[model samples]
Target chain A: MDTIDNLADNQPKLVGHDHVAQINPLLPLRKWLYSWLFDPGIPGNHQKAVDRWISILIVANLFALLFEHVDVIYEANKHWFHWFDIFSVAIFTVEYLVRLYLAPEDREFGGKKFPRLRYISSPFAVIDFLAVAPFFLQAVIAVDLRFLRSLRLLRILKLFRVLIPACRQFVKVNAGRTFRQKVHALVFAGEYGGTLHNIFDMFIALWVVVSVVAVVLESVQTVHYVLNLQFVILDAVAVAVFTVEYCMRIYSCVEEPGFQRAVLGRFKQARTPSVVIDFLAILPFFLEVFLHHLFDLRFLRVFRLARLLKLTRYTSATSTLTRVIVREWPVISAAAFVMLLLVVLTASLGYLFEHEAQPDKFENIPQSIYWAVVTLASVGYGDISPITPAGRAMTIILALLGIGIFAIPAALFSAAFSDELTKEREKLKRDLYEMLADGVISPDEAAIINREARRLHLRQNEVDHMIEKARNDRESVADLSGLPIHRIAAKPEHAIEHYKALLGQIRQLGILTDGLQFEQLARQADRLTSSELALWRQIHGNHQSQP
Target chain B: MTDTPEQSGVPLALAPALTLADMSFLVFLAAILMAVVWLGRIAYLEGVKTEVTKASGEAWVQWFTEASPKRFTPGFEPSSCAGGASPAGTNGKSAGSDAGASVNPVPERLWEGCLESLMKDVEPIAGLRNPFSGKPLMFAAKCDTDDRSLVGAMVLEKLTPTPPGSAVAYTTSSLVGADIIERKLQLRVTVCDKGAYPIRIAEVEF
Candidate 1:
C-alpha cells in the first residue's frame, strides 16, 4: 500500500495535457491527428482544411448524384462519377474506421459494449455510414435514389447546432452583466444565434406545430384511434411547457423598457397578441378539465389548434403577412365593405326576382342571403339555385362581379407585402448603422442589435448583408466633417426625425453648423428638397431660439 | 300542370354537397402554406453574411467587460474589450508558428482601424469569434473613445432603398453608410486569431 501511494505521488502530473497514449512514441502525432479530425481551428489549420474538404465533398457528392440522374450528363461523365463515388466511399470508410478507433475520446460513445458499435449507432455516425453505404450497395446490388448523398448533406447542415453552443460559451464567461441583460441576451436578443433563449423558442415553436397537427388530426376518427394516447401525452407536455413559458414571460416583462413596471408590465404583456395566443393555446386543456360537468367537453379540444398562432411569433413569413394586412388595411377594408354591400344588395334583389318562382327555396330575403354570399365570394355551394329568368340573370352578374371584387384584397396584400419586405431591410440597415456608431460592436451591442433584428423578424443572412451594407456606407460615404452622411440621408422621410435629434443636440450644446458642418448639411440637403429640406433648415436655424 | 309533375330526374336524388376530395384539397392547401412558412423561417435563420466579406469565413462579436448600461459606459479603455489575451501586454509578441495565434495589437487595439468602428461609434466593434470553433477572433479597426447616444427622435422610413427586407412602419430610422454601400464596393475585413495569427480566408463564392 505504501509503494502504491509512493508511486502515485511520484508520478508526473499532466495537468495541461489531455488523456492520450503515453506509452506510444507516436502519441503526439496521433493526438494531433485526432484534433485535426474533430476539432475546429482557423481556416488554414489541418482541422479546417479537413472540414472544408469534407464540406466540399458533400456538395460534390450531391452534384454527382444529380448528374447521374441526368441522362445527357450521365452518358458523358459516367466514368468520372463512378471514379468520384469510389474515391468518396474510400475516404468515408477511412473516416468511419478512424472515428471508431478513437471512440474513447468521444464522451457519449466512450462506454463498453464495443465502442465502435456505439459510435456506429450515433446519429452522425449513422449518417456518415448512410453516405457511404449506398455506394457499396450499388457495387453489390442496385441502389439509387432510395439511398444517396442527401443524408451526408443533412449531416453538414447540422453543423450550426455544433458551432452555436461553442459560441454561446464565450459570452457566458463574462458573467458580469445584469440578470435582465443576460435574459435579454438569451430570450430577446437576436444578434447572436445560438443562445439558451433562442433554443427554447425554437423548441416551443416545434411543439406548437406538433400540437396543432395532432389536434387537427384528432378530429379524424381513423387517426384518433391509433394516436389518441400519444395526443393526450403531447397535450399534457405542451400545456406544461406553455404554462411555464407564460409565467416566465410575464416574470421577464419588466426587463423591457416599455414593461418596466412590476404589475402593469405583466398586464401589458398579457394584453399583447403573442401573450394572448399563448394563453389561448393552453386554455382549452384547462377548460376541458374544469368544465367537463358544465357542458360536452369533446369540442373544447378544437381550440387547442390556437397553438399554431403562437408559432407566428417565431416565424417571419406569418409576420410578413401580418404587416401586409396592417399596411393595406385601408384599401382592404374598403374592398371588404364593398363586398358586404354586394352581399346584402344581391340577397335582396334575388329575393325579389325568385320569391314567386321558388318560394320554398328562397322564401324570404334572409334565406337568399346565404346564397348571395356564396355566389359573391366565389365559393358557390350550389345548395340553392335560382330557377326564374330574372333571378338567373342577377346571379350571373353577381358571380362575374365577384371575380373582380374578390381579387382586390389579394392584389393589395401582395403589393403591401412587397413594401413591408423592403421596409424591413431598411430598418435592419439602420439598426446596423446605429449599433455600429463607434465602428466597433461589443457583445452587448451585438446582442441588442440582434434583439432589435429579431423584433423586426430579420434573419441572420439578411442581417449580415445589411451589416456589410452599413460597413460599406461608413467607409465610402463621408462628408466634409468625416461623418457617414449617406446613412443620415439614406431615408428622406425619417431624415426629419434624425434632424430633430441633431438640431436638438446642437441647441443643447450651443453649437452652430457651418463650414464643415454646413458642408455636411449641403450634401444631405442636395438629396432632399421640398418639405424635408424645409424641416431640416427650420430645425437647424431655430436651434438658438429653442434654448 | 301539377307542381309535383315539374320534378324532372330521380325523385330521391341527393343534392350537391362537400366531398372528401374538397376537404382533402383544403387540407393540402393548409399543409402547403405551413410548409412555406416553415421554409421561410429556416431560410431566414440560415442567412450568412458572405457577400460583403472577401472571405468565406464567419465573424462574431464578443464582450470582454461585464455589460454596462449605455449611459454609464466610460470611454472604452484602449484594451478594455479583449478577454484572456490582454491587448496592453501584446507588444512584440511574435505570431509563432501556430496558424491561429494571439492577436498582436501592439500600438492600437483590435477593432480600432476599420469600417465597423465608423458605423457604430459608441461601442467599438471589438469582440469577434470563429463561427466553427467559437474561439475569439480579432479584426483591426480604428477605435476612438467617442461616446454617442440617440439624442433626438430617430427618423424611420417607409422603406430603405439600400437593400430588400422586411418593413417597419412609423419608427425612428437612419440610413447607414449609404455612400459606401451604395457605391456597391466590397467591404473587405480581415479576421485573425487571439495569437495574432492571421487565418487564411478562402473566398469561395457559391
Candidate 2:
C-alpha cells in the first residue's frame, strides 16, 4: 500500500517530465502551428475542416455529373474522372478505417473484425459514409439513369452539424442581451415575453408570408408551367430532412440517462423554441407532400416557405423574440380569441345590416367576416364596403376594436418583459449573495460580472457601489454576525423587483465570489430561535421609536 | 396536340441562342459551381494552412532535436525524444531504433514531397489533355478497370509539362483493345501493370 501510494504520488511528476521531453522538441513550432490552425475559443475548426472536405467531394461529384452531358469533356476526360472517383473512394475508405480505429472500443459492435460497418452505423459515421456512397452506388448498380449523384447534395447537410456547436455557443453568449429587446417587442405585440414563444410566432408569420407568396406566384398562369415535379420533390426533400432532424434531436435527448428520469425534462431541453420553429416550418411541406396526393391540395404547397422561420435559430435576437412569444402565448391567445369572437359578432351584424343594400359585397356572414378580418388586420382591401348608415357605424366600431386588438400583443409583451427582468434580478441577487459567502473573488469572476452588467445596460457605478456595499457589509459582520445583513436582504423577497436590473448591475461590476459558503448561511438560519425573533422584533420596535 | 419533332426529339446540335429552360439549367449549374467554389476556397485555404503548419512544426521539431541533444535525454524527457528510435519517441512512428540516430528519418514525408513536386512539374498539360478536374478522371478509370482484361493492372505516368512554374501534372494510361486510346499529355502515369500493347498518344484535342 505504501509503495502504491508512493508510486501514485510520483506519477504526475514523472508524466509531466515525460511530456516535457516529448513535447519540448516540437513545442515552439507546434504552438505556432496550433495558433495558426485553431483560434483559442473558436470551436468550429474541426467542423470547418470537415466542411471543406465535404465541399471538395461535392464539387468532384458535380463535375462527374456534368461530365456525363458534355461529350467533348467526357470522351477526353472519361478515364481521368473514373480515376478521380477511385481516388475519392480510396480516400473515403481510408477515412472510414481511421474513424473506426479512433472510435471508442465499446462502441465497436459485437467485437467484430470488421468494425467499419459498426462505425458507419453511427450518426456522424453514417453522414461520412453518405458523403461518398452515391458515387460507389452508381459504379456498381446498373441503373437506366445515372442521376444518383444528385443524392450527393445531401452531404451539404453535414455542414449544419459542423456549424451547430459554434453557432450554439454564440447564441448562448449573446442570448441574454437580446432577450429584453425581444420581450419588449412581444409585449408591444400583446404577446408573451418568452423568447422561444415569440420565435414560434415569427415562424408562423414567416410561414404565412411564404405560403401567400407561393400561392400568389402560382396563380400567375404564365409561370405555372415552370413549376413542375421538381417543386414537389423539393418540398418532399425538405420535409424529410426536417423530420429526420427533429426525430434525431428528440431521440438523442430521450436516450440520455438523465432525460429518462422525467418526460417534461426531455421536452424542456430538447423542444427548444427553435426546434418548435423547425417543426412548424417543415410542417406545411409534410402536409403538401402527404395530403396533395389524397386531395387537390396542391395550392397548399406554397406553405412550405414557412420553413424560413428556422432561420431564427441562427440569430440570438430572433430566438429571444420567439421565446417571448411563447411565454406570453396564453394571454395573447386569450386576447385574440376575444377579438375573434367580436369580429364574428360584428360581421353577423354587418351582414344583416348591409347585405340588403350591398348584396354583392356583404352576401353572407362569412363574406362579412372576411372583410372584418381584413379590416381588423389593418389591411382594408377596399374591394368591399358597407353602404348603409347602420352598416357604416358598425364598421367604424369594428375598426376601433381591430385597432384595440392590435395593441393587445404589445401590452402582453411589456408585462412579460417586466416579469423576465424581475426573475433575472432575483437570480442575480441570489448569485451575488452566494458569491459573497465564498470569501474570495477572482479577476475572471469580476470580469464576468462586469460583462453581465454591460449586457444588461445597467449603470456600472451603481453596480460597483452595490457590490462594494455588500462586500463591506459582509466584512463588518464577518466575525460576530457569522452572516451578513446584506446577504439576508439579498433574498428573493427582499431583493430588487427587477431581476434583470440587478443582474445587469452585478454583471457591470464583474463581481464573482469563488467557493461561496451558502451552507453557512443555512447553518446561521438554523441557529435563529423564536426567542431571537422576538428579540429582533423588540429591537426593531425600539429602533422605530428612536427614529 | 400532336408531338412535333421539335417538341419530342433531341436536338442534333445545340443552338446558338439558349432557350429559357436551358438558361435556367445553366443558371442552376452555375449556382452549384459558385457554391462549390466558395466552399472549396475556404476549405483549401484552411486545409493547406493546417497541413503546411503541421509539416513545418514537425520540421522544426526535427531541427530542434538535431541542434540540442543533451537537454533532451532519454527517460528524463520522453516526449522530447519523440521521432527518435527510443521508447521516449512519440512522433507517431514506432520506437525501436538507436537513440543516437537521426530523428524523423521516415520516408513518408519524402514520398509526399516527391509526389507534390511531380504534380507541380506537370500541371500545365492537365487542362490541354484532361479537361476534367483531377477527381473525376481518377474515378472513371477505376470504375472501368474490370472491363479491361487485366483486372488489377494499371499504369501511372508522371508527365512533366514544358516550362513548368509550380503546377502538378500526370497522365494515366490503360490498355484494353487496339481501338482504345491510351496516352494523353494531361494525366500522370505512375504505374503500368495492367494489360499488354496499350495505344499511346501525345495529346487530346476537344
Candidate 3:
C-alpha cells in the first residue's frame, strides 16, 4: 500500500478529493491504469488504443512462435526472435501485474472481499499468468526445452482475455429459448452480436488471409518443395473451417426475417453473394479431392484464392462499394456500353485504314479489336502501330476518344464511393439524433451507437462530437415549440423539420403516452396557430393512414 | 484430353424432339450450361502453370529413404541435380551422455524469496507448464502422515528420465512419496540435460 502511495505521489497530483481518492491513496494510479487497460469510461484514457496494441502484440507473439519452428527463419533471425520474446514477456508481465494490482477496482470484483484472490482464479488472469510465466521460468529453472516451448504456446490463450468476455456478452444478449435464435445471434452482425460477432468475423477473416497466402506461396518452386505438406494441411484446415461456417450459416439462416421457410430460405441464403463466396472458398478443395480423376481439376485449385473475397463479409468498405455499384448500376452500365461501342467502332475504322498497309496486322476486325482495346487503355505496345499517315491520324483521334471514354467509369466509381461514405456518415448522425431524443442513451442504444461508429470507422472523439451535435439538434427542434407564430411562418423549412422531429418524438412515446401525458401534449399543441394545426393534422393523418 | 461423345458415353437427345413447351426448360438448362462454361473458362485462365519438355528415350523412377540406397523403376527418374553432398559425420549428434543421468541435487529452499507459478492436485499433474514463465514447472508429492494424522515431512525427488531408444520420451519428472518431520519445505534440484534448467521450490506443504 505504501509502495502504491509513493508511486502515486511521484506523479503530478490531481486536485480531486473524491471519497475514493481520500479513502485509498493508491486509487489515482490504479484507476488510471485500470481505465487504460479495461474501461473506456474514464476521460482521456485510450482504452481502445491500448486494446489494439495488446491484440497486435499477442498476434506478433503467435507469429514469432510459428517462425521459431521454421529452421531457416529461426537461424537467420535468432537475435531478433530472442529480443522480441524478451520485449513481449516484459509487456505481458507488466500487464498481468498491473491488472492484478488493480483487481479491487475492477467492476466485477470490486464488491468482493477478496477481489485479488477472485481475479487470480479468473480464466483471463490464468491466461495472463501463463503468458508471462514461461519466460520467467526459463530464466530461473532448469526445465526441458520442449516443455518450455509448449508453455510458450499457451500465450495464444491470452487472446481469450478479449474473446471470452465477448462470448459471454453475446450469450447474455441472445438468451432466447431457441437454439436457432442463439446461432443467429452468434453469426450475424446486427443487433445481438455486438463484439462477439466481430471476433468470429475476424477469425474467419484471418483464415482467409492465411489460405490465400498459402496458395500464393505454393507457386514458388523451392517453397512448395519444402512446405508442400504444411501447405496441404493449411489448405485442408481452411476448407474444413469454411465448410463448417457455411453449414452453420445455411442452418440458422431461417432465423433471418425474410428467410423463414426452411428449404427455400437455405437456398436463398446459399444464393446470396457472400454465401456464394463462402461456398466457392471451400468448393475447390472438395472438387480436387473427390473429382480429380474425372478431369485435370488441379486447375480448380486456383479458385481457392477466391477465399479472399470472403473478407468482404467482415469489412464495411466492401458493403459500401456494393451499395455504390447497385445505386449507380444504370450509369455504370451505360458507360460500359459506350466504351464497348467505341472499341468496336475504333476496331472497324483501324481495319479500314490500316488493312491495306498492314494486311497481316489488321487482317480482321476481330484481331483489330485487341489493338483497339489496348490503344484506348493507353497501353501503346509498339508491336502493333499504324505506319500509314491516314491510319496514324485516325489512331491518334481514336486514342484520345478512348482516354476520355475510359475515365468515365473510374471517375464515377470514385465519386460514388465518396458519396456513399458521406451518406453513411449522415445516416449515423441521424441515428445519433434519434437515440439522443429521449435525453439518455440506454445500454442497448449505446451498443448500437458503438457498433455503428466502429462500422463507419468513426473515432470515439468524433462520435462524442456527433452526440453533442445531436443533443443540440434535438434541443433546437424542441426550441421551435416556444417560438412565435410569425417566426415559424418565416421559416417554412425549419417548421417542417421541427414537425418531423416532433413526430419521431411522439412515436417514441408509444404506449407510454398515457392520459396525463396526452393532456400535457394536447395543452402544448393548443397554443399552435391554425396553419400549424392544419399541417400537424395532415401529417398525423397521413401517418395514421399508413398500414 | 478431349473425348468424343461416343467414347465418353454421353447420350444425346434428338434436337427435332423439342417443342414450344420445352422452351423455358431449355433456357434454364442453357443458363446452367452457361454458368458451368463460365466457371470452366475462369478455372482454365487461372490454372496452375505446368512446364513440359521433350526428353531422350530413357526414363526411370528412383526412390529411397535415409537408410536405403536409391532404387530406380521404369519411366520415372528425375533429372540429375548437384551440390547438396555433405560428409556423413557433418550431421552427427554431439558427444554427450543422455539427459536422464545428468540430474543433480541442490540446496533446499533455493528459491525461497521468488515469485512462482504453482498447481496442487491429488492426481499426478501432467503437462503442468508454469503459467508465468511458460516452462514445464511441476512438483508432485505423496506425503506420509504419522498415526496422529499430521503430515510429518515431504521430500520430492525428481523422477528418472525416459530411457534412451524408448518409443516415447517425456521430459517431466515425477515425485516419489516420502515421510518427513517439517510442515513446510523448500528445495531446488537440477533436472535437465547439462543442468540447463533447475527446479527451485519457494515453498511446499503436504
Candidate 4:
C-alpha cells in the first residue's frame, strides 16, 4: 500500500505538459487539417465551413457539367466554364492531396499498417481520387469526349463526404420511429426532416418553376418550334415528380394530429386546396397522354400553369391572405353587392336617357350595361358614348360613383392583408420566446423557427435578431422575482410545465452557486430522488466546468 | 355552312411577338448562368485560399513527399538537373560520372517555372489561348510513372482576368532513367474547354 501510494505521488504529472504536442509547432495545424479532411466528428467551425464550401463546389460542378450540355451557354461562356473547371479541379486536387497526407492521423486509418495505402483504398478516398483523376486523365490520353463527361460526373460522389454523415445523423435521429413518421418528416417541415427535407423542398420547388416555365415557353411559337421535344420531356418529368410527391403527402399525412384517421384522414388531406392544386399540376400531362384522342385536349395544357400554385404551399403568406379574406368576407361581399346595384342602376339610367338619340349604340339595356361597366371601371374603350345631355351627365356621375365603390374591396383587402401579416409575425415572436424560455434551442425547435421565419419571408439575420431578442427577454425574466416555480406548480394540470420550470430554476441555481457549496446543497436536498439528484449533479458539474 | 372559318380582324402587328419573348428568355437564362458561374468561381477560390493558408508548409511537404520523387525538393534547379540527366543517357552511362552526379531534384515551388523553361526549349509551333476570351494560358501539370515510363500531363487554364497574383498554376514532371533516355518528353496538353476535351496537343523531345 505504501509502495502504491509512493508510486502515485512520484508519477509524472500532465499539468504543465498537457499540450506538450504544441511544442512541435505543426502539431495543432496537422491535427486541425486532419480533423477537417478525415474526421468530421471532430468539432470545429472551420470544418463546417470547409464542408459547406466543398458541398457548394460539388453543386457548382454539377451545374457547370449540366450547362456544358447546352451548346449556346457553353459556347458563350466557354472561358468562364474553363476557368471554373480549372478552379474546381485545383481545389479538389488540393483537397485530395491534403486528405491523403492527413490520412495517417485518422482513427480508422492510423491504427492499421500502411495507413496511407489503406486510405487510398477506402471508398471515400477512391471517390476523391476519381473526382480529380479525369481532369488529369483527359490531359494525358485521348479520352472519348462522351466518356469524359460521364467521368466528370463522378465528382458528385464527393458529396458523400457531407451526405453520408447527414444521412447517418438523420437515421440516428429517427431510429425506432415509424415509417409513416419518417415519410412525414421528409414531406413536412418539422424536427424530423432536417437538411434532407430542405433539399427535397427545394427540388420540388425547382420542378414547379421548371414545369411552369416550360408551359409558358411552349405558348411561344418560335421557342415551341425549337424546344418542343424538350418541353414535352420536361413536362413529363415534372409530372412524375409531382405525382410521387402527392402520393407521399397523402400516405404520410396521417402522422399529423388532425389527420390521424387512417383512410378518412387521407381523404380529408386529398380535399385540401394545396393538395388539389398538386393533383391538378400533374393531371394535365396524364389527361393529355390518355385522353388526347377523345377530344381536343390541347386546351387542357393551359391548366399546367396550376403548378405555380404549388409554391404557395411552401410559403405562409398565401395561407395568411386566405385567412384575411375569410375574416373580411362579409365586408367584401357587401361592397361587391353595392357595386353590383350601382352598375345595374347606371345601366338603366343610361338606356333611358340615350335610347332614342343613339339607338344603334345604346341598342338595349344589356348593351348599355357593357358601356356602364367599361366607364365604371375607368377603362373607357371609347367604343360607345351617350349623345344626349342627360345621358352625358348620368355617365359622369356614375363614373365618379364607380371609382369609390370599386376602391372599397381593394382598400379592405390591403388593410386586412397587412393586419394578418403582422399577427403572424407576432405569433412567430411568441414562439421564439417560448423556444428561448428553456435557455437553449434544440435542433428541432431551431428548425421550426427557421421554417416559420422563412414562411414569414424573414431574412436569416432578421430571424437571428428575433432569437437574440427572445434570449434577452428570457434572461431578463430570469431575475429573482420574475417567475415563481411553486406558484406555477400549484396547478396539477401544469405538472410537467412546473417540473420543467423547476429544473430550469435548479439549473440556473447550479450556474450561480460555487461548486463546493452547490454540491453540498445538492447532497443535502431530500426532495430529489436518487436518479434525479445524480442527473442534477451531472448537469451542474457540466455547466460549471463549461468555461 | 362553309367548312373554313373566317379570319379575325386583328392585324399581325397587334399579335403577340413570340420572337421578342423568346429572345428575352434566352438573355435572362444566359445572365443567370453567367452569374452562378461567376459566384461559384469567387467562392471556390476563396475557400481554397483559406484552407491552403491554414495548412501551408507541412501539408505541402507531406503531399509532395507522397506524390513525387525525392529529387523534386524545395530548392531544386531544373536547368542544372535536366541538363545533367541528358535525354541520351541510359541510367546516366552516356552522360558520364560528373554529369550523373550533377543531376538533382527540381524545386517544388518553381515547378511551373521548370515547365516554362522546358516549353522555351520546345520550338514554338503553336500558341495556346482561351478561345473565348483570347487571354494568355497557364498550365497545371502532374508527374507520374506509367508502365515504368515517365509521363507528364498538363491542363491548360486561362489566367483569371481580375485580382492579380491569383490562379498560380504548378506542374511536377518525373524523370526516370531508362524512360528519359529512350523516349521523348511527352507533354500531353489539354485545353480546358468542352470542345478540346480530347486534346493531346504537345509531345516535345528534350
Strongest candidate by lDDT: 4
TM-score of chain A of each: 0.57, 0.40, 0.75, 0.69
Per-residue C-alpha lDDT of model 3 across residues A1-547, encoded as one tens digit per residue: 1111132343222212111222233559877667655664553345555666888798888878876777766888899999999999999888888888989989889889999999999888898898889788888998896698789989888887777778766655554325555567678756666678877788888889989999999877556544545566667667756766776687778888899897899899999999999999988876765564344465687999999999877678887888899999999999999999999998998899999999999999999999999999999987898888988999889889988999999999999998988888899889878865555565456656766777888776687678778866875666666554454455677678677767877655643445345435655767656575455445445432211
Q: What ordering of candidates by TM-score runs from best to worst?
A: 3, 4, 1, 2
TM-score-superior candidate, 3 or 4: 3
**Residue-wise C-alpha lDDT for candidate 4, range A1-547, written one tens digit per residue:** 1111122243222122112222333557877667544465543324666777897799889878876876656888999999999999999999888878888788878878999999999999999999989889989999997798899999999988877866765665565465666668789876667667876787799789878888898787545534444565566567667877887788779888799897899999999999999999877766655563354466798999999999998777787878988999999999999988988898899899999999998888998899989999889999998889998888888889889998899999999998988888888888878865655565456556656766777775676577668765764455423345453344454456556666788888876768666555556775556687678767666544321
> For each model in turn, which proportion of the native inter-chain contacts is also found?
0.00, 0.00, 0.00, 0.00
Estimate how well candidate 1 is docked, as a DockQ score: 0.00
Instruction: Give the per-residue lDDT of model 2 (tens digit) for A1-547.
Output: 1111122233222111221222233445534333233222333234345445754575566547645555555777888877876786677666556555544343334256665566668676777678677767777986444455466555554544444544443333333333323223232221122333343344344444444455555556433323322233333434444554454345334334455534585587456766676667556544543453244444555555546656544344464456678988889899988888988997898889988898988889998888888877778898887788998888888888888887788888887776766665555555555555555443334444554554445564555455566665655554422334464355554344344445555444323321123224324667546574444335334322210
DockQ scores of the candidates: 0.00, 0.01, 0.01, 0.01
Worst 10 residues of 1 chain B by lDDT: B147-156
Q: In model 4, what lDDT does residue B34 have?
A: 57
Model 1 regions more than 4 Å off: A1-37, A40-194, A317-320, A429-547, B1-206
For residues A373-475, what per-residue lDDT tens digits would candidate 1 score against the true structure? Answer: 8998889888898888898999899999999998898888888877887887687677767755555554455555655666666665666567668866764
Candidate chain B TM-scores, in order: 0.29, 0.27, 0.18, 0.25
What's the CA RMSD of model 2 in angstroms?
32.8
Query: Where does candidate 2 stray beyond 4 Å?
Result: A1-247, A257-303, A306-345, A348-353, A364-366, A376-378, A389-402, A425-429, A432-547, B1-206
Better of 1 and 4 by TM-score: 4
